[model samples]
Target: MPGRYTLAKSVLSERKALHPSELERRDLPADAARAVRSLAAEISVTLDANAATAATLTDPALLHHIDTRYRELPATVHEAMRPPAGDTGVTIIGSIPLRDDELGRTPIDWQQAAAWAGHPERRCASYELDIVMLLLARCAGEPFGWQGQQAGRLVNNILPTPGKEHEQSGASSTTLLAPHTEDAFHPQRANLLMLGCLRNPDLVGTTVSSVRRVELDAAQRDQLSRPLLPILPDVSYGTDFPDAETPPIPTLSEVDGQHIFRFDPAYTPLDDADLDYRTAYARLTSELERVCIAAALEPGEVLLVDNDVVVHGRVPFSPRYDGTDRWLKRVNIRLPQRLRPAAEATETGYGQCVVAPFRTTLGIHT
Candidate 1:
């Protein structure tokens, strides 16, 4: 399989350099810029440390620290939530003191929050909700504010069982989320993903990402472009399983002539035994996995994945079901309507209209 790449050899580094105007507009104060650079440096170091760790994605101690620290912030708690974003695509509102008085209601057992049937009451009644805010919050901005469903949706949770019937959506322990774009079903997609760690998993669950800068070659790019790969709707893509299944959507699309992958290695099914598309799928997967990099985040650590330029996943973890289980407060956000236009919002075939089916494929459908 051949590979395809842009003239830019260092894609990720190039994107990291914000245009002077972009920096000024985002109000990236000198101190904030310095802080972001420092954080990035620290992350780079952490990535190096992970080189010696197991590859399965279990890392609880780091998660524990993140949970403990974010629990310290109080002001950011609300009945609804939206990720806070800055020039760096993420912000930390540590230990937000979210007490019952803040929401005029009694707080429930947030430590083990059951999936709400519909709109669950805001968790702000009481308890310190460790929130990690992000600039690019959701695929499509929801109807209400950032606190609404579309932006601040919680995807992974600490399930009672690991990959069992009860815990199919998430692993009982710290498990790596496979690399894929967030809300691939939404047309108005967010270019970024903000992950906030609230409770540390008993084991490791580092975030793994594949950098396009290092992955994909010209031939691979051409292969990805050849066939309209089908994206089967996964039941895990939704909260409650839908009655009927939808048709398979394309796995790749050209956005303004740029190659973008709507990759879901788990859910994307291809019978590539045949020569044409099957071979292409095989090459696509290999290239994507080749340049994968992992980042294990500590508790209170907010990690942002550039969705457009990178594919992200998680490492496996051990779920102890202890009180201090791994928990993350997730908030998704996208640029306001005033920023990017709607045509740029979604891929032509896959993602639904902007903000229509609040949640994408919830469960893996057969």
Candidate 2:
């Protein structure tokens, strides 16, 4: 049984977008989605009249309560997150409970949403959906946010910003969000990325490509593992460093017979690499593009990507910015463990820290 990530090769090509019908769909139990929605509505936790701001969202009490309160989600949800034999890493869980008026209009920008601290009415519409993302994220890992990105709010809002349609960040709509490992530059980047669609009136597709789907010769793998490239932070984080002074990191690595990867061609200074290394890197990039799959997530659908195994991006599209434009909520998650022991090292990318609101008791036997 092929998961959504294991779609037919005919559906993929360079910059080719997949129609929504071609992307496989899986639905969570209706009862479970409804129950979670109801549970979120009853939440009374607040700090200074804010229910879902950075401080309240990261509160340890609320995070633990939600995880423990409804730990037994359907098997489909857990199964969708795990890659079968690690062949692919993108999984879509759809049909969570949502209503148009309940979410209200999408926020103008992430900053506008952050300004809702003293106004409960503005944040009320999407509060439940944010909680729902937390509820789903705990099934695989602990949800976290970047201190530099969105001021460390656990859940992030992803929507197109006016006048930024051609930029490389998530706010760009007309420009293809280049394929990259989420937070590839940071040593403590997330182990999994969860994107939950709140409003996608245009059926815009999110592209995904996994390392497991490609084959590299031993020579090529060795070259890729030599820490020859340095990935810089995307512009969305509002951080920058002298590229030459930054330490190089591996585009691919192997540990205990398993593969770990870091890749961000847009941020990686390819001109700095030698001819042989660049050739190998070029091959890897070509293979990834050949296997890339574009899947459009419908409203209430959540896509979970294994950060180590997949590089995800978005296709270029025109944004209406008319309240119904494509909107998504993203969560960065930390798994129980990492492939590299050095993952524990603090290389604070631009002084940004993790905003973990909860102490997670995730099973770490993997």
Which residue ranges in model 2 land beyond 4 Å of their true spot? Answer: 1-25, 44-56, 72-86, 116-118, 243-245, 341-350, 359-366
* RMSD in angstroms between candidate 1 and the native structure over all alpha carbons: 14.5
After superposition on all C-alphas, the RMSD of every candidate to the true structure, in Å, is: 14.5, 6.1
Per-residue CA lDDT of model 2 for 172-196, tens digit only, reads: 8987787889998876678889999
How do the residues 57-89 of candidate 1 rate in per-residue lDDT, one tens digit apiece? 123432333323333222223202333233222
Residue 232 in candidate 2, Cα distance off native in Å? 0.7
TM per prediction: 0.52, 0.86
Question: How many backbone clashes are present in model 1?
Answer: 65
Query: Top lDDT: which candidate number?
Result: 2
